[model samples]
Target: MKSLSILITTVTFYLISSMYSYAQQTTDQIKDQQFTEAKETIIQDEREALKVEVEEINNRLQNGSISKTEADTLKNKAAEKHAKNIENRLIILKNTLELADRNGDQEKESKTGIYVGWDEDANDFVIKTSVKRKKEKKEVYDFRTKTGVYLTWGLLDLVDDDNSYGNTDVSVGRSTSFEVGISQTTRVFKKSNFLRIKYGLGFEWNKLTPRDNTYLVDNNGINTMEQFPSELRKSEVRFTNIVIPVYFELGPSKKIESQNYIRFSTQKQFKIGFGGYGGLNIETMQKLKYREDGRKVKQKIKRDYNTTDFVYGVGAYVGYGSFSLFAKYELSPLFENQPIDKNLLSLGFRLDFD
Candidate 1:
């Protein structure tokens, strides 16, 4: 009976010791898990706060609200703070692991060295967090819109004239027109960047050199074409106009792989434009250079030779690259009810410099 009692006591003691050890291990594991969770929460919060601050700084730099030097300084400061936070987290982890080893928690110690839930691999026992900046909302119209001065040269023609002269009666070289203008262009929509609105102010000067030595004479209120007795080298009737023009422009923009700003490029792209212009007759004059009695004589005369006061025209342009073919047909007659009815037409090239 004494031997059996001794045996029973030994078994009971061993079982109680085993139970007590298991209970102690379970409590330690719970404490370790809670500590890990608390540390993770702290690290996550710090990382998120740092990310927000970095993003704000980058956005300001992208929009020209902050200078490069300031941005670099601010970003460096943020990086330092982030690095410090990570260093602190790593230190906490190291202490936790040491404490787990001291407490004989082998499982927690092994897991800490095995894996770290982060954006990158943590085999080196360091945690790195990154701040991803959102793409900026840039004002596209300022770059897309073009403004510049353009030069125009066109062939001037008279249609439905009551004069004795035919279509070929005007000198092609001397019957020339010139235009100088400044234009502003803008994209209509953000998505539809190809469509644009262009408008501007300009001047138009038309010179008509008759084929024959004919001078314009105002008979009462009529402009009569007459011949000069002297041989003439040049006789040109000029009309100067101040006009406002508007057009709908369509083209592929100069594509650039850029993130910040854009500029006008010399890239070739297909483009088309159609528009109209209206203007007032600002001046009218006739210049004549002729030889009279073997001496060169020059004369300029201002006349009310019955030219129309208001003028308007419809025009279209098509081209590849910076050069374009252009044509303009006058909607209003050049001269009112006279012995001959006439309208002006122009054909040439349109060059855009932005």
Candidate 2:
């Protein structure tokens, strides 16, 4: 407690002495003293800037962006640069001080590291900093991967096992395929964005409408297409699937880089992707509409119908910016066991928003 009281008494006397010293100064005398002390402040500021530069270079070295030798060289160059700045600025400040002492008056204007001077044109006293540190801007958009939702619709055509395209059973205009999902695209390389990997999860729909008055008949465990005894207005089979699609995309992007960050943009850029999708069939449903006993009747049935449970397909797309021409062909057989083995193919337009 006695030591604390002694410290308080000492501080009180120091404050009184400082106030007395401040009282003795005229405006011109105070300005001269302040101008002289600014030399030390400038030197200290340059040294501090040099330290910050060294720390930044060390960070690059630790991150493997620069080698140790390069970091050392950068550090040395920064030190030399600050040293030279200190020398040159001190010489100028010393010359100005000597001129002021010889003239026995404060200078109206003088070039120093930090300057407080009278501006004749502006008719005012101005302060200026000769040394300035560069500031880099942070990018507003900065990501290697982009995510968005996608929707697709297309015409579906069935192909027989022996035939590459076309089937006699399903109508081309009546059959349709659709997909909706979330998607992501990522850059494949550290320094290049020309190549990317795109992947997504989606729900798939495949619909087939039979031609003529024929309907699917399940006899025991065997299924076949047969004519219905009753007149039929519509007969169709719909398949729902959950799928994961992946693609290797090739494209060009606009790159903007600085000391702060690197950003890649695909705005108005053309891109092409080739990939495949695979997943399990969720469910299959059959719908029939016909006249029974002179009254309209509709029937719905849910069954596997020996259809393949595993759904897989190859897909390709070419586009500019947000829209693309897309095509996909199903590789798995339509049925696990059937008289005619068939596959499905679809072509349509797609939109991706990111």
Candidate 3:
């Protein structure tokens, strides 16, 4: 188990790093273009202002409030003023660009608490306000809850009881589990976001395929496996549960602090969570496929197989970004009355889109 966990950790981190590196380097090559576009905008705006100033000077000359010489002087002064304004503003803009991070994360929280960052995905400027100012007072908002949807799927099998000598009756390779749900993460500390309470509601599906052409048989009240009479193409038992999995997630996040708001982001970072899940077994079903009298036949069996109704398990995960290596083990017995007790065990992957 330790070796397997280490392998999963290494592989998951490697994959996440590769993906993030590729994405971070894939720029639109639009930063330089933004400079040109901004320069053009400045020139156009100054020219328009210059034109208006010149018209006003002409109007003054027509009214005889100023002579041609005076009007020309005024127009020249206005033109020169606008030219200097353009030069100065352009310099400021250039300096701002220089201050930006070279890696294209040019998002800034300006000194004046105002920001206009380029949104590459939106192809527009994303303007943000820091705090609301009223007279001499400012109101700042700090929110602590973040929510996201998670999807998980992985290997599933049953762990034989320590007291029992029976072997596993299901094929580990053929068994699988899947879960999908919404999660809400809240900072556990007032000043630090390193520790968080992550909880969610998920719908889980666990399927186990019996080994050696065996099918689940309810011998009176006890659920047992029996060899299929015909050539068994497939034999599987599936359980669906509505579970609530809660985990205490610990991770470091980069702080995106502004004058008005502060946020901690764990995107593309390392995190580990240890928690458990408890829920009710909503449904149980079995599927069978075989050939009978030269005809293919399929059967869907739904009956009480003495399966546990309430299910609970402990789980842990460690990963970077959205992907994680997830492992879980159930404490409750799978069947109520059985010769050998079997506990459900699973090792899989989880993706939390938080």
Per-residue lDDT of candidate 2, residues 141-176 (tens digit): 457788988888888877875655455677778888
Model 1 lDDT at residue 333: 78
Local error of candidate 2 at residue 67 (angstroms):
85
Error of 3 at 329 (Å): 0.5
What C-alpha lDDT values do all the predictions have? Answer: 0.69, 0.75, 0.77
- Please write out the lDDT profile of model 3 over residues 93-113, one tens digit for every residue: 554443343433433334335
Model 3 deviation from the true structure expressed as Cα RMSD, one decimal place: 23.6
List ranges where model 2 is wrong by over 4 Å.
Answer: 1-141, 256-259
CA lDDT for candidate 3:
0.77
Give the number of the best model, judged by TM-score: 3
Candidate 2 has its poorest 10 consecutive residues by lDDT at 21-30
lDDT of 2 at 174: 84
Compute each candidate's TM-score over C-alphas.
0.57, 0.59, 0.61
Worst 10 residues of 1 by lDDT: 110-119
Judging by lDDT against the true structure, name the best candidate.
3
